[model samples]
Target: MESQHSSTTTARAARAPLVFVLAAAVCAAALGWTYWAFVQTTTGQFADESAWQEAGVAAPDTQLPFLRFLDTLPTISVVIAAAAILFVAVRRHRYGAAAIAVAVIVASNLTTQLLKNVVFDRPDRGVATLDFNSLPSGHTTLAASAAAAVFIIMTPRWRPFAAAVGGAYSVLAGVATYINLWHRPADVVAALLVVGIWTLIGGLIIMRTGNRWNDWQGFGTGWASSRGWLGLCWALGPGSLVLSAVLYFSVQAIGPAPVPGTATLPLFFWWGLAWIVGVGFTLSAAAGWLFADQARRTSARAVVP
Candidate 1:
């Protein structure tokens, strides 16, 4: 009986699929981001071939090198790298996990930058032709890669919160990239693609790690259970964003929409989108809370019978 129980636990752990999921996350993030960028910039450049101008969203102007540098910092990645190393050292007691994580992280950076150049396609000096390869963004790859690294270490109980935090960090990377370079805003969104894919992938990979993040779900951890999962997303992520977007446009139609060289409240309206979405950052985790609560009640009823 003891051996059987141990084996069951081992099987559950194996299902986490950490490395495989990491690779999957990388593929999703990279491919999705590349698609988005190509559509936004490459397609535009292709049309005007000579303009070398891509029809994508340009980043807002800013002058904060220090902040930009901070945003680009690989702090989260470093921490994750450490955690992965520590886990292997303690549990597996092998130096390989950490080594692989570090190598992947470093290699991902190179591949990411290479892809960025290819997709964004800036031309040589005195060239009037449009460049092709800048579709998949490099900075985005970096940001996403970092997020992926972090997600691998996160517990499911921490998944929602960790993902949100990861999103915020990726945003920081975007800000830094934007301030330093006028790279397409679409390019920055590569970070979003990277992080989202990994979070989803890594979430599934290590779901059991956070089987019970707490005695009970706490702040940021969503209501437990399948229903809670859907409800959390509806209440926060998509639903809230939809609400904010509607409100933004409604205000614009009702009042004066900020036009170019105008008041720029519309930009604030845009930022409002971010604020509303942030709710999902926490509420999504709180989603799991409902599931646990329901299960407990069911177990209680069964016992009473």
Candidate 2:
């Protein structure tokens, strides 16, 4: 029976990385679709415009001060956060976690810049807008990567809370960028996707390294369970989608009229921002739960006499 259990655990452990990889692929494809739809399609351009105007309105009244703070949240601050997380992992002797954390941060940030500057070109999609590309906001990417670093280093037990707090912070940062007109919703979403890909890569590395400290106690009935975050993600993900759809169709019913800066823009802008926050937080929470669960299972196996 012990031998059978060991084999089962090992098999499950082996499958986790594959699951993460497949999920990563889906996120990448989603990001591509987002680009093609919003960047290339006419309707997408309108939606982008709406989102931008909405952000501008919100920036001055509600989000400006917050945006300024986030804007001033320097690259060094992100580095310090990553370093602190890395230090915790190293102190716990989780070298694999430390390395993966750094990789996720460095690789995700570099890829965001590369895509914005070099690898991907934003053609004139006929939208009357800024000339430069801004599909992935660097500020949002930095915030999200720092969050990912935190999620990567934490043990399974702490991940649910981390998921809630870190995911919220990242989502807030992304939304602030939109409100401040730093980037569009697609830009923020793309940054989340980029961080997500590196997160999967980092997960794969952690699984391979087989760090014992990564494990956690099994789930319980409480709200803090690994299952709790997963459930919250499910709720938030679908709920946000439904709300966004409602907003989109309701605005569409009004028809594009009056003027550019008045009616549809603000409505569509909020709609796009809603989707961005939903997608960003849902993905982060789900990924956090995935790692936490995997760690719990692996740790459980490791402790068996």
Candidate 3:
């Protein structure tokens, strides 16, 4: 009886994170598909082309100076991620997790950039307004990097949860770029696809190597305290995503989206509903509450370490 009970407890503990990662994947695919083609599929609307064309708006390439500056985000994200892996190496002294994190982050980021320029580069309508491989987005790629990096070392079950949180942030990143006019609706969709495909590849690698997923363990707040990190994430993470989506879609519905600085803002509105209400807050809140509820019962059943 004692051995059986211990085995059950161990199994449950390992299952949690995998659940989160899976959940994230579902939410990402659903939401991503919606923004990328929800209305169009149902109503035959091609806003990316129609919205601007009817209004005589023309899409333009990223400006040289700004493009040069913004192009550094991928690099910055990579550097920060490298340091994160280094910290894990020096502190935990775990080569497995450190190596996986470093390798996945670098490979995924580089692959996305290369695909962006090589496979996706094209001039539509005598200009680079659109490209074929642009279906997956790099902004979302970075977002995935930030989120997936955490999960790659964790148990398989935790992915859904990470995806839940990570996917929201990924969507938020896409929206922010869209707001800043850095990418089009299609670009955002492409970003999500890119991240999903690469991250899935990474997950498969982990699975093949037999590394289990880890629970968030939740980061510390800016005060450098674990509790502080939880508090900050609890307060700002959801809220920030909500605010960012609200603003993005609100602007989207109001104007001629797919065009910069003067389109609709309805998309932000849908974004809020999908993320804050659908996944981020509503679903996430319920998930967190349930996880906490389960955690207590779980703790009573087994030793953590």
Decoy 3 TM-score against native: 0.52
Give each model's whole-structure lDDT: 0.44, 0.75, 0.47
Tens digits of per-residue lDDT for model 2, 1-305: 88767855674564367788898998899878888887778777667766786667655686768667675766644765667675776677676677778888899999999988987766676667777778888998898888888877776666776777677778888877887777888888889999888888887677656555654676656665556766676677667867878888888797853443467346777687778878877786678767866676666665555
Q: Rank the candidates by TM-score, best first.
A: 2, 3, 1
* Structural similarity to truth (TM-score) of each candidate: 0.50, 0.87, 0.52
Error of 1 at 32 (Å): 4.5
Worst 10 residues of 1 by lDDT: 47-56
lDDT of 1 by residue, 65-125 (tens): 6355655465645665567557755775444434444554566666556556643445443
| Evaluation by lDDT, superior candidate among 1 and 2 | 2
The lDDT-based order of candidates, best leading, equals: 2, 3, 1
What are the runs in model 1 whose C-alpha is more than 4 Å off? 2-62, 65-67, 70-80, 83-107, 117-132, 179-182, 195-305
Candidate with better TM-score, 2 vs 3: 2
Q: What does candidate 1 score in Cα RMSD to the true structure?
A: 8.6
Which candidate gets the maximum TM-score versus the true structure? 2
**Candidate 1 vs candidate 2: which has greater TM-score?**
2
